[model samples]
Target: MGKNVNFTLLTMLYLFIYIVASPNSTIDKNALLAFKAQITSNPNKILAKNWSQETPFCNWIWIGITCGKRHQRVRGLNLANMGLGGIIAKEIDGLSFLRSLIISENSFYGFFPDEMGNLSQLQEIEM
Candidate 1:
C-alpha cells in the first residue's frame, strides 16, 4: 500500500511539472502581440492595463482572456457586451490557436478577415 501511494504521488508530481514546463511556455511573444494588435483600440482604454507575457496574462485578470491551466496558452477570449464600434481586422488573423471569441452587441460592421479561416482551432465564436 505504501509503495502504491508513493508511485501515485510521483506520477502526480511528474504530470504537474510536465504541464507547467511545456514548449508552449515559449509561445511566440510576437504572435501574442500580433493578436493583441488586432483588437480595436479603445479611446476609453477598456483592455489590458498590465497585459504582457512577463506579467502573466492569466494573472493580470485581462477582461477577455482565458489561459489554459495546463499549457498556459490562451484558451479563449470572451469580450461580450462591451460597447464599442469597429470591425475585426486582419491583425487577428494570425492567431491560429484562438478557441473562442465572444464580442457581441456592438456597432462593428465590415468584413471579417478571410485569414480567420486560418484559425482552425476556434471552437466557440461570437461577434
Candidate 2:
C-alpha cells in the first residue's frame, strides 16, 4: 500500500513538472504578440484590444488562434479578412508546433518569410 501511494505521488509530481515546464508555453504568446506588432491597421480592432500582454494568449478572444490540447502550443492561426496590413515577420517561425495558417483576404504586403519553412508541423497554409 505504501509503495502504491509513493508511485501515485511520484506520477502526480511528474505531471505537475511537465505542465509547468512545457516548452511551447510562452513561445506561442511571444509569436502572436510579434505578429500583432506588425499589423499597422486593424479596422475591426479585434487583435488590438484582445491580444494584450495583460492576458494569456490562449485566453485572447482573437478569432483564429488555436491552442494544442496537451501543451497549449499554438496549433493554427487564421487571421482572415480583418482588414490588417503589414509585413509578415520571420518571428512567426517560433510557433514550431503550428499546423495551419490562413491569412487570406488581408492586405499583408511583403515577401513571405523564409523562416516559415521551419514549421515542420505545418500541414496547411492559405495566404
Q: Estimate each model's TM-score.
A: 0.62, 0.83
User: How high is the CA lDDT of each candidate model?
Assistant: 0.65, 0.84
Model 1: per-residue Cα lDDT over 46-112, one tens digit each: 6545346565555535567787765566777776776656667565644556788777775566887
List runs of model 2 lying over 4 Å from the truth. Answer: 1-23
Per-residue C-alpha lDDT of model 2 across residues 80-124, encoded as one tens digit per residue = 888888988788999998999999998999897999989999999
Spell out the clash pairs found in candidate 1: none
Residue pairs in collision within model 2: none
In terms of lDDT, which candidate is strongest?
2
lDDT of 2: 0.84
Q: How many residue pairs clash in each candidate?
A: 0, 0
Q: How accurate is candidate 1 locally (lDDT)?
A: 0.65
Highest TM-score: give the candidate number. 2
